[model samples]
Target: MTPDNFIQNQKQQSSTPYPYPYPPPFSGPQPVHFSQYTPPVADSSILSHIMHSISSIDSRLSKLESMDKKLDKFDGLCEAVDSLFTRVKTSESDVKKTHYSISNIKLDELNAEKDNLWIAQASGGSGSPGKGSKLKKEIAEIHKQNSELKSTVSDLNLVIRPSLAHGCAVWLPSSASSQQIL
Candidate 1:
């Protein structure tokens, strides 16, 4: 038979009623049966849903990346803190060395000052009163001689008053004026 006739015959057989009185008619489409017909989906809404999911995932990925950067910065800070701790430890040693040097210098100065004090005491003759009294007498005698000379100069000043070249007048007591003129 011809292809068209064969197709028509198959259609007629399929459309014919079955002998069973209770069976329902095949209510679906004629079984053209090529590829399966999935009803066309409302793809725009689905596409939007898929894009939203992707955007949410992307946002999460960005947050993770930001957290990673913050962790890196924290690690850098920890390294800096370790370096500072090392410097502080080194400074402690330096401080110890400086303290040692200062103590040595202080001890040497103390010894030198002690020696100076001893020398001063020794020169004052075992801290005796007689040596101190003798020194005082000599100092007093020297001051008395200085006063006598000042009196002589003041007397000479009175005599030479007219002959002397004057810058400014300095007052001299009559007792001490002798040394003033000379």
Candidate 2:
């Protein structure tokens, strides 16, 4: 083929799916017996075989690219599934029970703090004010911590667990007891 015709054919061939660092069309493997004046029939057969090999290589390259994309998505899905499993397992750790215990502790501390304040006011002692104020602040901090913990526990129960389940994946925890680390 003339150079002009070869260039035009290459342009058309490039529009199809091909891997990066595309192969040069006219720069195919050279024939071993270039010095020999080969017969036209032999030349034609060799050209056909080379074309077939190039086509096969292109097909395999396309398949590999597609598989690579699919494997990336699979990896992302696996990571999401793993994180969901961890959250679900964490939610089952009696968080609600822990929150309840913390609430009780906060309430008892608050009552004690109030009683100390009242005693300080009734007795008119300068020494009791510092202890009473410190107790009150500690109680307030404990209450705040308890509030955050409860909110976190509730959100895990009401939101995260259901949302994960809705995504068509089942994040199952191991049946082993909680004392064992996985």
Candidate 3:
């Protein structure tokens, strides 16, 4: 047979119009053979598997949502803790300031008291004017009185010694005798 006729014969013997083993490349819209086309049948096991996968995905999504809520609560708690920490720091600073102020006040008071005490000691007896001199005058008067009492006692002893040596009753004033007896 001739080559062209042999090629034509080969085309007629094949099912497709194209002489190549693969389908033809892109062309205009072709008529679809719906009569020979079959819709896919639903498989119970495969459908169940897909449903289970979707349910698992939904469950995972729900868990993630719950975790997100928990994270939000945790973030709020963190903020509260941070605020509390700041307040604590503020309180600590205030306390330190108060302590320093109190200590300074106490020191100032102590220094004033020390100065007052030194002044009081320098002037004697509560820093009153002439109070120390008055006490000194009183003490001197007491000493003078004590010396006079001693002289009088020595005179009495002189009078009593002779009478006791004679072993006789000495003439004495009643007051002197009473003083001697005492």
TM-score of each: 0.44, 0.32, 0.51
Better of 1 and 2 by TM-score: 1
lDDT of 1 by residue, 118-174 (tens): 565555655454665566678789999999898877776776675465544444566
The predicted structure with the larger lDDT, 2 or 3, is 3
Query: What lDDT tens digits, residue by residue, belong to model 2 across residues 1-82?
Result: 9978877777777766553346545465557666654655668889999999999999999999999999999999999999
Model 2 lDDT vs. the true structure?
0.73
Per-residue lDDT over 4-82 for candidate 3, one digit per residue giving the tens place of the 0 to 100 score: 9988888989987777567775576544654655668999999999999999999999999999999999999999999
What are the Cα lDDT values of the candidates?
0.76, 0.73, 0.80
Q: List the residue pairs that clash in candidate 1.
A: 150-179, 151-178, 152-178, 153-178, 153-179, 154-177, 154-178, 154-179, 155-178
Off by over 4 Å in 1: 1-42, 125-182
Which regions of candidate 2 fall more than 4 Å away from where they truly are?
1-42, 94-182
Q: Residue 114 in model 2: shift from native, Å?
A: 26
TM-score, ranked from best to worst: 3, 1, 2
Residue 33 C-alpha lDDT in model 1: 54
Residue 142 in candidate 1 has what lDDT?
Answer: 100
Model 2: per-residue Cα lDDT at residue 2: 100
TM-score of 3: 0.51
